[model samples]
Target chain A: MGEPLLRVENVVKRFGGFQALGGVSLEVQPGERFGLIGPNGSGKTTLINCISGTLRNDEGRIFFRGQDITALPAHRRTWRGIARTFQIPRPFGTMTVLENLRVTLEYAARERARAGDPAVEAMEILAGVGLDPKAGAISGLLTQIEMRKLELARAMAAKPALLISDEAMAGLSSSEVDELLEILLRLNAAGTTVIMIEHIMRAVMRFSERIAVLDAGEKIAEGPPDKVVSDRAVERAYLGE
Target chain B: MQARWLLALAGVLIVGAFVVTRTVDNRYVYFAAYGILQYVLLATAWNILGGYTGYVNFGTGAFFALGAYTSVFLIQAVQAPLVVLIVAGGLVSGLLGFGIGYLTLRLRGVFFSIATLALAVVLETMMVNWEYVGGAKGISIIRPSAGPLFTNYVQLLFVVMAALAMGAVAVAWFIEHSRIGRGFATIRDNEEAAECMGVPTLRLKLLATTVSGCLMGIAGAPFPYYITFVEPVSAFNLSYAVNSLAMPMVGGTTSWVGPIIGAVLLGTLQQLATVTISSELNLLIVGVVLVAFVVLAPEGILGLLRRGTRRTRA
Candidate 1:
């Protein structure tokens, strides 16, 4: 699939004597809807954090867009078109919704200064996220779903080609999950590769093009969503079958 | 458009104040204005890092002392122009800021502030023992001529201080409206979120610290000439820290104009107290004002003004 957009090769991460991620490896293709799932303490977040440069891998290489990005700083990785939403939406509480988007827009502008008007680009992003109406509202006062949307909007503001959404629908209801899934589908349709790390089984089954299950920092199964869900190893890992 | 009009009104008022000071022959008025100007610059500088970036700096006295001593050394060594010495002082302080920030920007709030305070104490001790700078006895600067066109150097110094204050305010305003300002706000609010969103928080914090230190240095650089003496006691005085810290806290730590307003009101009151009441009473009043604002009007006078304006508009 056009030389995988992201590749993690034998990545290892440790916290003193405890190994958070032990030689984990994964690849995400361009425009792919990849699902990352595992039980709690399965190193799902640790693997993503290492991929996103939030934590450096103890060993192994991370290649992004055909280049070694192993040692690149988190912001530099973002500039290279990698953006992630937090597990907990952390909007700049003091700023308005529009201003929160504006900060990301400004970072993108600084990186690509020669690329036309920044304010117009910022507004376009807000519109895309369906947050144009509440643009001037204080971010701290936003409702739960609105905050999730803002988290996505901020990730998209950098105009990243690859978007990592970490539990965007964590605390939402079933209907809210569908709403967020629709937004992610729309974003993916516009050619942004998305890696959705979610624990919701039905949503992940519906959204992921390819699913990978991690059990205790190891990839126990990888295949089509239907097959992966039906795999004995996956069932045993989740339900202790 | 509304903001622009407010800025224009501010500009007019500032120019009018300068004109009145220029025309008036009253020394007391100039002295009061000069003192306010110093506090305004110091508080504004402190606000760059403390308010905008959400990094409270307790080392205001260190940068101030650095500028004062740099001015003294340059004047004593090369007899340079006051303007040049001021710039030199600012550059030296900026470099020091860069060095300190590079070493300590990884630290979170209180730890960073404590490191800076430690740096200040260490620097103060070094200056106190260093004999070339009069070894705590202090060095008296001979006031250089301001040319025949202007005879009253105090008035000239007042004008210079006022100009510097205006420049500091202008820079703060520009930063507040710019992208860097927004980035700083994000860093202050949620640093991890900011980094994930592609903000280079470390670099931005360092930039704020450097610029803040430079401005503080420039504010202090003229003190030896303005007061015509420089001693460790006055240069590295804890009062500098108290004034810098209190002014921003009383003004509202959220906006550009907060510190400027706080500095002027508090500074004018202090000067008046020093003249009419005991010198110690001035600090006592500042302490009282600071506590009152912290407890009751935490948003400060400028915050109240902003709220009042918003309420009126609504």
Candidate 2:
């Protein structure tokens, strides 16, 4: 717990003439519940893309558990125990919900898959995410909320040490958001470190033990939610005042 | 779905086909059989990348022609046996597939497809200019002595083609049920999500392309000997491209059975249409049938059949 679970130092990412992220540095402690809140187009997703290896950073180093992982591919980062959810749910429409979970479990827990039944384990994960009843249902047939649950279940199946949840509550009703928040909290309580990226202020403020705010490709504030809520810079960044 | 069951079924079908062909004792039957089975092989090979992994390979004709020409070159050089020629041809096409996939797989969607289509044109032009294998004038290979396994060359070739088609089906089935197939499914579903979930998408895509190309190339290996001549235009005909793509799309793309069903159904229909009516009408029939399938059942026959069962249950 003394060492950072993930470390990003001076990340700079650009697409052609536009700079998406500029010299952002951050550290996530092991077993920490961290929140990242940002306005639209504020480099939150880009920073995540660097950490997750979706896009390479033009400058900077990213480390996971003291190992330099800036150059690793996305699948390698996942194998190294970093799993992320997408902002938009992307379940395989042709497969059943259980099959979607099996893909992750089969790949990530390859050693476990050698000994145990992936179908049984996939059902267990579906049950965990409260999608057990829809295990056999085609993924495309799922409701919006169910799709989100399947996405989380798929991530959970990877058995990551650090879970980066990207807008898991997007487009959900308040009750659905609470349900998702509870699941995330329960998961964090069970020992997975969480870095939640969200636009939902209420969810972020309530879920975070420590929060970081991003505005226009810069970190505007870093502290507890209440402190960040009162910070002048954070207020000005959010309100553009 | 199971290996043992599939193996057993293949054994029965191979033996059954042999008995039926022998009983027919007609050259036209063997010729028709070979023509139809060729598509069975091509469609199965194309399905590996197209139906399963969802990568459009517009250069199947090039790969097929490459395989045939590889054999022509080998035959001209030392008169290599059909078996050796097939292996050499597959190796050449597999390497080409891998090379082209490496260059273009980075580009997604229509761009990648256009690259493959370009590959076909480039390769065909090279074949046209390169006079070693007679160039555009084409070359003919006299039939070689037959092995002890069969009484006649054509009969032996038919048996070999049948075996290859069955083997291709088996390979596709094995991939469909294995971990590799699941990885391919993930790629087909969503490449980005699959990558973040720990699936190595690029590696799997490369594998599918190589294997698919190799098999398509192998199917073309025996074609020159069967036709006794090879021309650049005929070898690289767009019919190979059209039929291979349409067969799997019309039959189904998601499972091993789809390509076989599509190839057999469409191939047999085309053969009959060619015999009974104008040969040029075959292409129109394929186009119309493909358009109908795309409009009515984009998932193909397997999907359409599943819908039928769903209605009964409801």
Candidate 3:
């Protein structure tokens, strides 16, 4: 692959004396379907948080699109076309789905006001996430799967070159997971890089072009899905052998 | 079509009041209307942050007091025009709002509210002890001469206050319909989601609080001249905070029309109570009305109207 879209170098995050992420490093290439998987408490979320500027890492450098973004604030990172969906779906409950997308579109337009293209762009995003018809419904009234779709719609509304899906398949049935996975695949096919962090092994294994296994805040395995899944350390980490 | 009818009816009522007050020469009615206008402005200003953004500021009285004192000092020191003083008051209060919001917007929920309350106490003490602007003794304002419209200064004050009231309403309408307004609603509903969706929550909130404070300050700036006195106690009156909080809550905290309805209804009732009943009982009546609405009509009059309309459609 050419230049990596995102690079995390030796990220170290501590909560007082506890090290949540101990010198973790990773890279996501442009238009790559990368899977970040680990057992619980292996710092998957912390790593993503540091990359997204939600948490400051004491020792790390994060480069996004060939620029240092480590010290940038969350909204600044968002404006630079880095978008993320939370593991727990967080739609603006008091507003309609259309209003939620509109706010995101307006924010992005304000940052990069290309003349006369925002509304059409927003509607296209809504259509891509399969939320166009439900746009007028109140977000609080959406079902669990619908809320997840809205979260994805919101992330896409910023027209990010890279999209981070943090456990978007959590709490969904098998068919629902397939539906969401299909959407992620379609987005990746359309030239948007995707980093999907999921605990659902089958889905991640099927979706990731390359898999990286993090165990106890360290990269224990990195390879094709089949090789990483069968690695002695990856198996031991999951089975706690 | 519906909105135009409402506007026409409002115009008719205002013109009717002007004609009747002119014929009867009732300075009292004009004074009452002026007070109602002030409350309308205050409630609308408070709603900008408290209602729209879900950030309840208990320190509105502090901003109001700051505006009153700023105007008093400027008027006494350099004899600025009333219009200039009003705008200056707003600018001063807005700056204070920006400073306070920068420090405290990180605080969530009731902590932010408590911090704002403490701000009022600190401001009141500072103004009470500072002797530059007459300190605890208070400042007296010499009313600016009216330019030949009416020898009766009260009528002129009423007109000015009415214009300001209209301006406040227009601002509330603009914000309610704008993109900033939708961003505020998102922040109110879920700040994390709002930020995730790329809304710059801090900047939008700061703008809301600053604009809210500026308008409150302008509303209070003219009060020193209207009452012809500026004392720390009255300028920092806890009643201002109470009315600012209660009017919006009692009117429906969700819409622009809520505060207007609350202010006019509650303000007229308070004026009538103060005139006929004991002045001390006026506050008692306010407290009673606030409690009644909080318990019985938590969504306020506007919510009631919305529900009534929906039922009719059904």
Candidate number of the best TM-score:
2
The per-residue C-alpha lDDT of model 1 at residue A83 equals 91
Candidate 2 docking quality: incorrect, acceptable, medium or high: high
**Considering only N, C-alpha and C atoms within 3 Å, which residue pairs clash in candidate 3?**
none
Question: Compared with the true structure, what per-residue lDDT tens digits does model 1 show for residues A1-241?
Answer: 5799999999999999998888888899999999999999999888889888888999999999989999988888999889998888899998988888778877843565425666667677778878889988999999999999999988888788899998899889999899889989999999999999999988898999999999988899998899999999999999995
Model 3 TM-score (2 dp): 0.93
For each candidate, give the interface RMSD after superposing the true interface residues on Cα: 1.2, 0.9, 1.4
Tell me each candidate's RMSD, in Å, in order: 2.2, 1.4, 2.6
Expressed as tens digits, the lDDT of each residue in B1-314 for candidate 1 is: 75688678667766776577568988778778888999999999999888888888899999988998999888988998989988998999998888877854477889988888898999999998987876689888998986654557777788788778878877788888888888888888988788877889889988998999999999988888888878898899888888998998898888877888789889989988988987888778889999999888887887778779999999
- Clashing residue pairs in candidate 1 are none
Q: Write the candidate numbers in order of decreasing DockQ.
A: 2, 1, 3
Candidate 3 residue lDDT tens string, A59-111: 97999988999988777888888889989888888788887777888875467
How does model 3 score on DockQ?
0.60
Candidate 2 chain B: minimum summed lDDT over ten consecutive residues — where? B145-154
**Candidate 2 wrongly placed segments (more than 4 Å):** A111-115
